[model samples]
Target: MIVSGKLLVSLSLLVLVFKVSHGQPLVPALIIFGDSVADVGNNNNRTTLVKANFPPYGRDFVNHQPTGRFCNGKLATDFTAEYLGFTSYPPAFLSQEATGMGILTGVNFASAASGYYNWTAQLWGAISLDQQLNYYNEYQSIVVNMVGEAEANAIFSGAIHLLSAGTSDFIQNYYINPFLRGYTPDQFSEILMRSYSSFIQKLYGLGARRIGVTNLPPIGCLPASITLFGSGSNQWNIKLNQDAILFNNKLNNTSQTLQKSLPGLKLVVFDIYQPLLDMITNPSDNGFFESRRACCGTGTFETSVLCNSRSVGTCNNATGYVFWDGFHPSEAANEVLAGDLLAQGIDLIS
Candidate 1:
C-alpha cells in the first residue's frame, strides 16, 4: 500500500510528538551558529551598531524585553527549539547564562552582521565565524570539566547544530563594498561555499553529527534591500534576489557533497527563500496585511537605532505585518518559517 506525502509527514509529526510527550527530547541540545537570524543575544554586549536590545524590537517578546534578537519577538530558531521540546532556548555564548549548568541545554554563537568571510564581520565589529568556532571549542572544554568526557560526548553527538548566514554577505558586503565588486556573483558564492565547507568539516571534527544550515532568504524583498538597491523604486530588487538564488543553489549542492564525503553526517539545508518569498508576494494568503513595508517606523528602511520607540509611524501591532524591521521578520512570520524549517529538518532529529 502506498501513502500520500502529506500523510507520511503527519505520521512523522505524530511520532515526534509522542517522543516529546514522553519526556524524551528529540535531541539532547539545540546548538546554533549563524548571523543575526539565529542570534539570541550574542551581540548585546558587543559595541556594534547591529544591536537590537531595545524597545519596539522585543515589544512582543516574553516580558516585553528586547533580548537583542532582530525580530519583534522570537526568531525562527526559537520556535524550532520549542518544537524540539527544549524548555529553554539556547543562551548566547557571550551571555552570563552560558556558564555552568546554564549551557546544559545548548548555547548560541551567532552574531549580527556576520558572514562566511571574516572581513565581512570585521567591517561591522561583529564576531567572525572562526571566532565563534573557537568559542564553541571553549564551551566543549567547560562541559567536559563539569560532566566528564563521556557525558559531554553524548551531548555533542546527539545535539542538533544549526548554522545560518550568507544573506549578510551579499546585502551588507558584496553588494555595497567597492573592493568586492571585482568578483562576480558566482565567484563570490564560490568563496562562501568554500568557507561553508570548511566550517562544516571543522564542526564534524568537534563531534557534531546532526547539522542544519539555513539557506539564503529572498534578499531582494527585504525592506532594507529594497531601500538600498531599489533605485528609488517601490519594487523588489530582482538582481539581489537572483544572487540569493545562486548562493542557495550552491549551498544545496555543497551540502550534498559534504554529506556524501563525511560519514554519519546528517547535513540538512533548510530553505527559507521560497517560504519567505511566498509571504512577501502573497501576504493575504499568509495572514499578513503588510508585505511591502515593515511594521517599524516608516517601514521602508528603518532598523536598529532608526527603528526605535520614538520612530514616527511605527505600527502599534506587528501581528498583521510580515516584517518587524527593515531586515528582520516579525514574530508572526517567524512562526510560519519555523514550521517549514521543522518539516524540512525532520531527519536531523529523527
Candidate 2:
C-alpha cells in the first residue's frame, strides 16, 4: 500500500528530527515487560498458554472488549503514558497496526504473559524479564528505523525510560524461593537478583538512563494467594503474604545495588511495597473495598476464571473493587497507582 501523505510526513519528520538532535528528547516512549500486570496484549496475539484475551477483561473501556489485557480496563503503564502526553495507552509495537509507525511520545513493549525465563510461556508463564529484553531490542530497532540514529539517541537520553517488571518473577514464576527447583529461598533470591542486575546493566548499555522501576507489590495479598490461603474464608492471610513482602524488599534492595553499579543510571524505585502494604492494611485510605477476593466470579471465586468467562460472571462494579481478576488490578486501581507513581515528580534522569 502506498504510504499516506500524513505518514510520509511523519516519517520525514522522524528522520529530520533524528538528524538534528544529537541527544535530545525526540519524545518519551513507555516500554513494558513482564506478566499480566504490564501485559498490554501479547497473549491476545500469541497462541501461548499465558493468555487473557477473554471477555470482561476490557469491560471498563470502550466496547467492553477484552484486549487480552489482564485488567478490567487501562493498565498502570497506560496511565503513565497518558501523563506524559500520549494518545491512549501506547500499544505493543508488535501489536500496533504498523510496526514502523511512531507515536509522538510513547510505545508499549510489554507483551502479555511474558517472563524472564524462556520456557515460561509454555507453562502459561508470564513474559520473562529476559524475553522482555528481546522485545526492547526490537523496540530499539523500530525507533532507529523510524527516527534515525541521531534522533533515537536523543530520545533515549531525553525520554524517560520506564521499567516495570519482576513481580511476575514472584507471582507467576514458582521460583520465588526456588525451593521447588531444590534451591533455598536465599539461594534463589541470590541468583535471580544477579541475573536481574545484569539485565539492568544491559539496558543501561542500550541507552536507558532514566529508569523507573516499580518494586513488587504485596504478592501474598493477590486474590489468587488469598484464595489459596483463605480457602473458603474471605479473609486474606497476613502471614502467607509475608513472602511477597520479602520479595518486594529483595527487588528494592537489588535496585539500590544496581544504582551503585551503574553510576550514570538514574534509578527511581517506585516503592510499591509500602504502598500496597498500607492499602491492604488500610483499604479505605488506598481506596479498596475488597482486598482478598477478586470481584470476578469463577467456580472457585478467585481469578481462576478469566474476567470474561462465558460460564462465570463478572463483578458488577469494577471501580469499587480493588482487583479485577485473581492477579491483576482494576483500571480504577491502576489509575490511582499511576497518580501515586507520579506523585513526587520523577527527576531520576533529568
Candidate 3:
C-alpha cells in the first residue's frame, strides 16, 4: 500500500509532536551554514566588503542595533529558531558568544557573499564553504569539551542543520567573472553540485543527521540582478531566472539521491524560489506593497556598502517591502518565508 505525500507529512508531524510532548526539545539545536541569507554576523569581523554590521541593516532588530544581519531584523533562520522553541538565536561561530554553554544550542557559520565554491567566496574575501566546515569541526570539539561526549553526540546527531547558498555563486561570481564565464551555466552548476554533495557528506561525517538546504530564490527578480542584467528595462532578467530554475532542479534531485544513499540522513530541500516569486509577482496578495525594489537607498540596485545610513531615499519602514536591500529579504518577507520553510522541513525534525 502506498501512502499519500500529505499523509506521510501528517504522520511525520505527529512523531515530531510526540517527541516534543515527551520533554525532548523539538530538535536539540539548529546548525547553520551558507551565504548572506543565513549569516548572522560572521562577516562582521572578517575582512570582507560584504559586511552589514552597521546602521540601517538591523534597524528592526532588538534595540535597533545592527547585528550584521543583512536584513532590517531577523532572517528566516532566526524565525525558524523561534518556531523550534529556541529562546536565543544561535550565535555566530566567530562571535564572542560561541563559547562555553553559549554554543550548546548551535552556531551559525554562514558568511555574506560566500557560496558553495571556495573561489566564489575568496573573490569577495568571505569565508569559504570548506572554511565554514572547518569551523564546524572546531565547534564540535568545543561542544564535546563543554557537554561531554555523549550529550555532544546527541546534539550533533539531533540538531537541524541548514544551508542557504548558490545565489552568490551565479550572481556575484559566475555571471560577472570573465574566467568563470568560460563554462556554461550547466557546467558551473555541476561544479557547485559537487561542492554541495561534498559539504553535506562532510557534515554527515561530523554527525549531522537532519539537514535542510534552501534552493535558489528568483535571482532575476532581485533588484540588483534587474539593474545589472535587465538592460535598464526594470524587468526580471529572463536568463538569470532560468539559471536559478536549473540550479534549483538539480538541488532537488540531488537531495533526493543523497537521502536514498546516505544512512539515517533526513535531507530536505526547501523551495525558496516559488514563495519569493509569488510575493514578487503579487505583492498585494502577501501584504507587501513593494517587491520590484528594496526598502534601502534607491531600492533598485543598492546593497551592502551601497545601502547605508547615508543612503538617500531609504524607506523609514521595511514592513511593506519584500526586500530589505538589493539581495536580502526584509524581515516581513522572512517571516512569511520561515512559515513556508517550517512547513516544508517538518520532516527533518520528525
User: Model 2, residue 244: displacement in angstroms?
Assistant: 2.4
Instruction: Tell me the TM-score of each prediction against the true structure.
Output: 0.98, 0.82, 0.95
Better of 1 and 2 by TM-score: 1
**C-alpha RMSD by candidate, in order:** 0.9, 9.7, 2.1
Kindly report which residue pairs in candidate 3 clash with one another.
Answer: none
Candidate 1 RMSD computed on C-alpha atoms after optimal superposition onto the true structure: 0.9
Best by TM-score: 1
Model 1 backbone overlap count: 0
Better of 2 and 3 by lDDT: 3
C-alpha lDDT of all candidate models, in order: 0.92, 0.65, 0.92
The TM-score ranking, best first, is 1, 3, 2
Deviation from native of the Cα of residue 38 in model 3, angstroms: 0.6
What is candidate 3's lDDT per residue for 1-350, written digit by digit as tens?
Answer: 99998888778767765655666468889999999999999999888899899989999999999998999999999999887877789999999878777689889999999999999999999999999999999999988888799999999999999999999999999989999868999999999999999999999999999999999999999998999999989999989999999999999888888899999999999999999999999999999999988999999988889999999999988999999999999999999999889789977875
